[model samples]
Target: MWNPKATVENALILLLLTLSVMAKTVFSQNCQNTGCPGLKECCSSWGSCGIKDDQCGFWCFSGPCNLTNKSYGFNYNVSAGPRGPIESIVTPSLFKRIMSKVGNNCPAKGFYTHHAFISAVKSFQAYKRTVAKREVAAILTHFAHGSEGFCYKEDKARGKYCSPSKKYPCEPGKQYYGRGPLQSIRWNEYYGAASIFLRLPLLKDPDRVAQSPEVAFKLALWFWTTNVRPALYLGFGESSKRVDGRLCDNLHPNDTKNLVNQYVNLCKILEITPDEDARSEISAFWRRHLSALMKRCASTRASIITGRYGLSFVR
Candidate 1:
């Protein structure tokens, strides 16, 4: 017996399944680990995406969500508001002074502009919590080192840096060697992580990290706030260990030394004393607000001495 109603129902089921697969293929960028895009969007406790109100409002990875069984941790009410903090902290003139240290021989000189850095910084409001003379110096020190004094813009696009994972599958033709300041490596994880967090199509278009300076700096900041900033209170040594433990363990003692020396130099440039324990550093820096107000635009004083790094700046 030909059952028209049954056939119609089966067709509808197939269509719904197809749509679900497509949706997951396109937008599911490892929501389980990094959560969904946007600050208010929710990644359900078991790995599903929807507005904050979905699933009893429980935001698993991100949010002090309205509906929740538990709040693990979230970036609520921490952003530096918008558009002014980075500019105020590192003005164009100040950034130029910082850039002046790069040898004229360096490549990609124009790529790492203050405008690009400021533009990228706008997307990361959590950065507000990490802004201090010592912290800022640490941030820029890693920036210069990971980007190799802002010289090497793109990786050779060699080697399939992809790993097999259903959560964040690799695009067939794309390579995922970390780009930009953080040199955000591990495509299977960080690229997808960045995709969800930044709400950008980074997994599909990983090149954006290298092609646009703003995107590049955003990748760096993403890595920094998520990984480095949290460990900052432990001290610079721990922060460096978090960045690359091998370097700290005598794998490349010189590179580790370079990190400390670069931080010291940048602190000098900002007229700040480099020290341990980031919370106290921020508290202390703000206490001397009158000086910080002037030092906020840390004028690049004297030439920045050259610090050589390995060609591989991966972190």
Candidate 2:
């Protein structure tokens, strides 16, 4: 009548077949024909993901794409470090405004007169090539200072004594001539930056900066990352303003916007963007060096944003 053994065997075979089909469906579902969101999908026909090239696919997430699995087709790691706090605070629109104001206007001629500026640019290039964050900052600081008056010619007696000065000294005004990225001026700043950041005895001999531009360039990087950055980002100089222009009571609505602009301009020079993913990396760079100043100073955040985004008051 009823063959129980045969029926059981048939049922088992059917179950196995169903399980195999289900497994195939699940495996196929891992990848899609179209590229996944947040990830640059490659080989839609093959159901792969990754950067545009024919390399392996990367796992896609909501916020940022993970590139760990991808092969080394590209040279640089687009996403390797933590994003900075400035990313959230700064915006694209604000950065454009800042760059517009601080347009690259240094002279392209005169080697002797433009030596400092040239050195500053070279220092920046070195930083980019090396990815030395502190060095990059120092060079920028030097640039900021040099841009103002590092090698400017001042009239001694309002054109009456236009033949340079012996008392005032024709050898580059110390206080007024801080030109470079971070705008470091005064012997104190230069020496301090050199000593602390670059670990050189530049403070003892101020002429070293002019005499040895390479050494000065390295010192400049140190200063911007360590000193100037702290003063701008985490210090009470610019970050703590309230609406009424007081620490608790003073605030400028435009201040935040302005700071963002400055950051964007810096990004343009450095070729960085303020996307959500990139924010952490940039912030980490700022936080590591400027920790003490940021903690001690209240308005450090505001100052940083303003320095990068607002009118730099270089002159």
Candidate that scores best on lDDT: 1
Candidate 1 runs further than 4 Å off: 1-84, 128-130, 276-315
Q: Against the correct fold, how does model 2 do in TM-score?
A: 0.30
Best by TM-score: 1
**Candidate 2's residue-wise lDDT over 208-303, tens digit each?**
554554554455455444333332322212221100011112224344223334433454555554222344344443332233212222355437
| TM-score for all models, in order of appearance | 0.59, 0.30
Residue runs of model 2 more than 4 Å from their true location after superposition: 1-142, 145-181, 185-201, 228-262, 265-271, 275-315
Compared with the true structure, the alpha-carbon lDDT of candidate 1 equals 0.57
In model 1, state the lDDT of residue 291: 23
Deviation in angstroms for 158 in model 2? 18
